[model samples]
Target: MHGRIKGEAAFRRYVARASDELRQANYTVSAVDLIVTPTRTVEEVILSTDGPKGRVDLPIAIVTDRGPGGLVEIRMYFSTWPITGEHAIRPPLLQHDPNVHEKGAVGDYQRALAAGDLAATLAAFEPQATVREPAGGEYTHTGTAELTELYTLFFSNGGGIPLEHCTVPDDGRACALEYNVTQWGRAAMPPEAGVAVYVRGASGKLIAARIYDDSNPPLHRPDPSFAGCVL
Candidate 1:
């Protein structure tokens, strides 16, 4: 808890405070992600903290409860379990096909991803939109809250994941894009190739997305989509 727990702003303040405190204590913190949903708040911070003993790598997950007023409580979960996952993340191995025209929304996504513009990237999605990552997994992301978590974690660790398209389907209702994502730092896995499907809503904004890629379970496959995707 940071403040009187007023609203989302207060919640964000708490997050900033947490990061600040960690840094001030000679602990270098790299945030993995932060999720502030209607009922829950979770933050994943990777810390390299030093003390009398020495320096150690710590993957820290901080969780908190959320209420109408704001954040409620906090806790931390740690594990000796190592972080491992394979992904085909790199600068687009192949160039974007000159002949293929890209969709506006999809194109915006690609540019935002390259620029590491997290907020701009998120603004492309509808509030209740759903997203599936580049690698097929047991989990799917739905709504703004989940999306926030997905991107937050990604931009924190994933760095600038550039995508060079090999294909962009002509179909307006459904478009599939083949891409290569960039691997996160220090926590590197195998390279990954991904396909993302982008579908438009009646209002013409992206409403749903699904991804298919070679990323393994341990690596966090945040966003990569457009082929073999279902609406």
Candidate 2:
């Protein structure tokens, strides 16, 4: 129990013990199988168990990481209801990095916008970051400078902007934001409404962002509102 358990056999034994414990408690449970992924960082195991009053079917997925420190994360994905019926359960989003805070991510982006801090805003993103447009479109920024330019252009336009909500799913590596942008200024601003942004990254940085929106077509103007804006 002290040393590291290596290979499938060791893992099976561990699962067997856990299953037996449940059996003793009059719970119907079984150890299915262990899956070792190619990356070696993730090991997923499946468990099929039953609930009380013979009314529930519980299917659980347990994910583990084989690193310097062995760690396991268990999640229950499906469970049977007591009166309604059997249905799939929506698992709550869990963050992988404990250091990341949802408020920090949302606050940083908002602060950067208010201060027009291009460098700071871009700094929050990963080196290769992609931002998807509202109309099933996408744009990838190669460097921090380029990302800053995009941010600058976005705020300079006179538009009614609102950040509805931000959720950090799968522990800080990804975030989903619901927002709306309306109104527009000549030669620079674009009208928008009801936008959804999905951001994913690691190490407290943003790697990718997928945006979905239903709005008017894209407009490209020659003269931007912030003609002399910098930094």
User: Which candidate gets the maximum TM-score versus the true structure?
Assistant: 1
User: What are the lDDT scores of the predictions, listed in order?
Assistant: 0.54, 0.40
lDDT of 2: 0.40
Cα TM-score of candidate 1:
0.49
Residues 78-131 of candidate 2 have per-residue lDDT tens digits of 222221332222222332333433455545764554454656677767777765
Which one is best on lDDT? 1
Q: What residue runs in model 2 are displaced by over 4 Å at the alpha carbon?
A: 1-101, 136-138, 158-162, 166-171, 182-193, 215-231
User: Candidate 1: minimum summed lDDT over ten consecutive residues — where?
Assistant: 222-231
Q: Model 2 TM-score?
A: 0.39
Per-residue CA lDDT of model 1 for 1-231, tens digit only, reads 132445678768887987886686587778744444446555556667664456555545454666787656654433221222333222233455656556777777766766657787777777788886532233468888887876666555545455546555435565656554434422454544445666777766678776555343232443433111111
User: Given candidate 1, what's the lDDT at residue 54?
Assistant: 63
Give the poorly placed runs of model 1, Cα more than 4 Å off. Answer: 1-101, 134-137, 182-191, 216-231
Give each prediction's root-mean-square deviation over alpha carbons.
Answer: 17.5, 16.7
